[model samples]
Target: MTAETDLIKLYSQRILALAADMPLAERLEAPMASVKKRAPLCGSTVTVDLDVEDGRISRFGQDVKACALGQASAALMGQNILGRTQAEVEAARDALKAMLKDGGPPPGAPFAGYDVLEPARDYKNRHASIMLALEATSQAMAEAQQADCA
Candidate 1:
């Protein structure tokens, strides 16, 4: 397909809708862990705050300032974040990375929402932005896990 067609597919209606519907899209007060990631090429950014209990996220929040692709990714993560264990969140992030970088299948159920982003694989410049949400979530989960151990 042509670049225009690919672009159209990348920014489909579903992606736009998801971009606007991120849950818990705010910053938590006194969060146990927080992470912010920026896409150097586009300057898109996403911040995540988390509280984990018993290895699962008990609370989650975020501020996403990015292009539609990034927002859609954040929305997918936000929609499924609560109660996810750190391992689960990290696995989702890894799966997303593989999908984008290695042309692998979309993340599994729950994170299956990420399937819509498959068209993004051809746009390397957008990869980091697309990854920011899950990247921050995984990092925040790690920090929360460490804090819990302390």
Candidate 2:
């Protein structure tokens, strides 16, 4: 098989496992902030709700409706977001975008698992789907912070 085929296989297998075992897959009953994002390129959507305490994520929940890649991305975010701050999530989001669009380095630890989707860099059509989770999480965090200040 060609290199592209190999990459595709790896991406598929990893995504399948992540999606099947997605963490924090349920929606919260009363989140401090809730936000939904859609990736127009793939019609992938992810809705995230979270509670913050002392500027850190205290709880998180999400409703995901997307392709395997989107699901995997959300799963990773769910797994590591329990103690993250808005700035951290935004940094990871920006780093992930740069990695996919400009060949920047993958995100650092905590969010480093995103590197698994590196093969997606070659498939521009998948970028939006991959970004859904990060975007939604960022929005939710920001909103929750604002609410706290109010």
Candidate 3:
């Protein structure tokens, strides 16, 4: 196989592997906040639900349908953000955006174990698919925090 083909295969395999262990569905208690995002160009959609308590996320669940990249991104987000605080989540979001836009390493531990997403920085069009879940979850968390403050 050509070098380009090999890279694609490797990336696809990594995404699939990340998604392989995710539960088909997740359950959440009430007082949960929800947000949805769509990449119209790719027909990718992700809806995230989160429950926050004492400023930390107590639960996270999502309904997602899209390409492998989207699904993998959702799975990764779900797995990593379960017990994080809103601040931590926001920081990670910022770090990810910085990494994508300015091309640098992530800022902190919130992104610690998920460095595989770094490859996505160069993936261009695939970036939207990869970020769908993160965007949804971040919006949901922000709304949830707002409602809590009100």
Candidate 4:
């Protein structure tokens, strides 16, 4: 069917592979910070847990419930989230948003794996799901940092 073909085109083999083997798929035994993000439109959700050290992510994990696009996005974010600062994660999140909504460039390095999602630009509805992991990660990092300050 046309719709199926279109989906296959959008969710390519690479995307499926990333989704199938998401990094940091397990939860951290003890997280310094945690955040959950849900895509209201699709009901997809990602729960992120992490610990920060020296202003960078020291450990990371996630529970992802979403379509292939969301899973792939989470996989990419999880793969590289460790060692990243909240500012870096937020920058990647912003870049991804621009890429999806404004036809901008892919996110910078460390999160460059997000480039694989370029095809998803046409599917505006899926944007939130794809960005959920980064959103949760950024928030968790900020929370951890704030707690450290407090």
Candidate 5:
């Protein structure tokens, strides 16, 4: 197979593997905060839910229906965000956006885990899918924090 084809296959397989490992129940639970993002060009949508207490995430979930990249991104977000604090999640979100937009460096230790998505940087269209969950999570956390203060 050509190198390009192989890369596509590899990324696709990785996404599938991540998706397969996600538990449905974890993605369906009610969230203290929720946000939705859609990639209109691809008709990909991701809805992320979060429950936070004392600045730490107490619960996390999402309902996603989209391409492999979107699904995999959601799954990865679910796996990694379970115990992280609001500040940590925000850092990761910023890092993820920078990475996708300019291939900029990651946002330090709290967001280093986002490196798993580095392989996706070269895949342009996949960028939107990958960012969907991150954006939703960040927005949800922000709104949740605001509500807590009100």
Candidate 6:
């Protein structure tokens, strides 16, 4: 395939549209937990704010500063974040990492949409940025869990 095709494949219209429509694009005023992650290779940063209750996400928000790929990943996470448990978030994170780093398949429902990011596997440098939302969410969940137990 041509270089143009590669670019087009990586930056498809669906990905771009998801990036444009960032759900939960605001920070929560009193988040139960918050975390920020940065992709050094691309200087992409994402900060997530969340509230958890009864072992599930009750509220969520994010501040995304990255390319279309990162934004799209965040969009997918935001779309599926509500009511998710720590186990679900961690499962998605692990599955996404395995998919990108070890050629594994995407996670099941609630996170299967991340299959769109399959193209990102070919670009190692973009992996960190693409995984930012998941990383931040996982960290935030941990923090919330700790506070809940405290």
Best by lDDT: 6
Off by over 4 Å in 5: 1-12, 23-30, 105-116
Better of 3 and 4 by TM-score: 4
- Cα error, candidate 3, residue 6 (Å): 5.6
Question: For residues 27-130, what per-residue lDDT tens digits would candidate 5 score against the true structure?
Answer: 54656788888987787988777877888777777788877667776776777777777777777777777887889875566444455567777777778877
Alpha-carbon lDDT of model 4: 0.92
Q: Which ten residues in a row have the lowest lDDT in candidate 1?
A: 104-113
Cα lDDT, model 4, residue 82:
81
lDDT of each candidate versus the true structure: 0.91, 0.89, 0.73, 0.92, 0.73, 0.93
Screening candidate 5 with a backbone cut-off below 3 angstroms (N, C-alpha, C), the clashing residue pairs are none
lDDT of 3 by residue, 1-150 (tens): 777985686477777787675542364557469887998778888877888888888878788877776777677667678678877777777776777767877546755645666666766777677778778878888889888889
Model 6 scores what on Cα lDDT? 0.93
RMSD of 4: 1.4
Note each model's CA RMSD in angstroms: 0.9, 1.7, 2.6, 1.4, 2.8, 0.9
- Model 4 CA deviation exceeding 4 Å by range: 1-4
Worst 10 residues of 4 by lDDT: 1-10
- Model 4 clash pairs are none
Tell me the tens digit of each residue's lDDT in model 1 across 1-150: 888888899999999999988799989999999999999999999999999988889999999999999999999988888989877888899999999999998889778779999999989999999999988988898888888898
* Winner on lDDT (5 vs 6): 6
Candidate that beats the other on TM-score, 1 or 3, i.e. the better one: 1
Lowest-scoring 10 consecutive residues by lDDT in candidate 2?
6-15
Which stretches in model 6 have alpha-carbon errors above 4 Å? Answer: none
Each prediction's TM-score versus the true structure? 0.96, 0.93, 0.82, 0.95, 0.80, 0.97
